[model samples]
Target: MSAANKGKSREKPMASLCAGAIAGGFESFATYPLESLKTRLQFGALEGGKPLTPLQALRETLNQGGTRALYAGCTAVVIGNAVKAGVRFTTYDQFKSLLKDDEGKLTAPRSMLAGLGAGMMEAIIAVTPSETIKTKMIDDSKRAQPRFHGMSDAVRTIVREEGISGVYRGLGPVILRQGANSAVRFSSYSTLKQLAQGSVVPGSQLPGWMTFGIGATAGVITVYSTMPFDVVKTRMQSLKARQEYRNSLHCAYRIFTEEGVLRFWKGTVPRLGRLILSGGIIFTVYEKTYPLFDSIF
Candidate 1:
């Protein structure tokens, strides 16, 4: 491609990133309640056992903490997701462009590799504080008298109690889960989209809804397949002031041995549901908004 063409291609990824970030932020806001419930379910109460059904948990959280509680750590959620989505989308596009030049065509496996790289890179930077605050927010909602008041307090307390390292407690599992999750997600979405594009009648394209459906299926599969890692990630990060887990692997083993293997998949239902909803919103907004931005720019 000529320099002008290369510049245009570069601009596309940045536009995709901005569009993906906006979509991710909006989706996170819309699904905060489900996310809050999913986190509580995963981390469990300060005690143990399933104290609340998903609906009961939602009601209790709302009654006790009000609407604001649903949105706890939303700042971190948006920022983290924005960074994750932006990077993932932008990097995926860049990688695809590189692959096209190298191989003369795009393929599903190549997209998977791109997604894996992007996901791992973003997960390391984005998962730590985002998840730390999320756990704290969920923990706070369960208490009569909350521990940390809000996002700032949670950050302050984590740093004070456990230092900066504490905030990144579950970095290991996060990378494992999210990296695989992103790989499966984008790769599957792209592969499916490519298939759909070909299947459409001449002079007609696959609709945005079709793209969303494909993306949501990929998101659910990715989320559920890696959910055990997520359970471990949540537990490791949500430890109380004095509480500690030996490590991610140790935590997984303990949960398997003590709690049973089923414990590893705890909160899978709500998580799958959350991912579907969030994924739908994300892809829909991203696909729709990118065209608008492209036209504007």
Candidate 2:
């Protein structure tokens, strides 16, 4: 372990939580436009229109409401992701600490297990409600008679009309998707870091560029592996979810039977664009920021 890892091992979870919040907030702000485009692409078939390319969607969104349209639900996502990342990193670190062996080695499987638990916790505590609101808000933005004026307004309207469960619309798939996402990302990132550094030592730091590359590679792997879950989660959280599908399983089934299997990856391009940068930005920021936190306390 490097001094960084040593500090991390000794530090409390609050350090990683704060560091992760900073990382997640930055990542969300930087990649939100791509996220907006992705959600639109996911709903393309349901929109009853010709499918639009990313550029066309960007043009249309810009025409509709200028750059502001490109960030339709950015505030919700930024705040949600910040809290989600904080929870995820804090729990992941705690889990990892507990899972390490007598030699203090964290095998790939153990790392993946830790990540899985962290993701599930974050999804339930932070991701599902925020995503439900963000999805509905973005959907609202597409309507001529948009109901939501802002994030708080969206939350209020949803709660008023549908009750508290409205904000947890996609809880099932969100947990599944997030669990798989973290498992793959953290494990692959750890393995790649180890391979790059030629060591299996936990928290072995790498150069900035290498860390970014490894994180992006992990993101690509995670995207392809979990896209179907993501599509289902998005559909379940959409404002029309009540009418379109009964539940997460039914939503997935409808997507498969009505749209074809490939529809599960409908937003691949834009999501890929965002996640590639997201993985890099998140890990690099987390790794760099974590050390500062570690040193402080």
Candidate 3:
């Protein structure tokens, strides 16, 4: 390859990373409130029947703490999402490059494998503290003292009480859901984008809107496909204050036995909505910003 071509190729990953971070930041900001509500709906029910509807929860949260309550974990969310998007997009580019030969054709399964690998790595590195804070914030409504006042409080509390491992309470389910979610989400989005591009004019490509739509569709599929694990993870992490379950797998088994299989998909509706909006925004921003970054850098 020519030196210019190599330089352009090298720039793609960095450009994608920048674009992804911008997109992810916007996406996270937009959907964080719904995400907070979804977390509450999933884990806020008293052990004995009294689950609050999403609207009820939102109303109660506002009544008690005002609108600020809805964004309790926004800090963690922004940081975590920035890292997640950056890594996921950049790694995806790197993986695709590695998989493609000089002919530029990518093999089957390589995309999926790349997504899975990126997801697992991202989950392990980025999920723990942010998730811990998010769970604590969601559970704060039910507590007398509140587990955490803010992200800093949550992190300090986790480390102080249970040490570093405490912050990773549901790491297993996190990895499972995120890994599979990434694999399905990225692979589906890429495949759909490719298909969409094929139908466009010879010298033209699918619009950014098309990419967003495809990404949102893929996000919905990914979230729903791995939602059961998500439920388990939420339950496991949220129960740290309550100590209700031993671990993620135990939490899953307990929910299955006690609440039935349907329990595994609790709050799926809100989750689906959240993912669709978030995915659309993220993909749109990432796709639109990529060219700008390429031109600048």
Task: Give the best candidate by TM-score.
Answer: 2
| The 10-residue segment with the lowest total lDDT in model 2 | 1-10
Model 1 weakest lDDT span, ten residues long? 1-10
Give the candidate order by descending lDDT: 2, 3, 1
For model 2, what is the alpha-carbon lDDT of residue 171? 94
Q: Residue pairs in steric clash, candidate 3?
A: none
Q: Which residue ranges in model 1 land beyond 4 Å of their true spot?
A: 1-11, 101-104, 201-205, 295-297
RMSD of each: 3.4, 2.2, 3.2
Candidate 3 residue 25 C-alpha distance from true site, Å: 1.2
Candidate whose lDDT is highest: 2
- 1 or 2, greater by lDDT: 2
* Residue-level lDDT tens digits of model 3 in 1-297: 001123114437667778877887788888988888888777744446577787887898798778888888788888888888887777776776676656664444777787888788778888755786677666765565566777887788778978888778788888898899888887787677767767788545457677779878987888779889788878877745346776667777778887788777778777888888877788777767777877766
TM-score quality measure for candidate 2: 0.95
Per model, how many backbone clashes are there? 0, 0, 0
**204-250 per-residue lDDT for model 1 (tens digits):** 54577886797688778787678888888888877562355578777
RMSD of 2: 2.2
Give the distance in Å from residue 112's predicted Cα in candidate 3 to where it truly belongs. Answer: 1.4
Ranking of all candidate structures by their TM-score, best first:
2, 3, 1
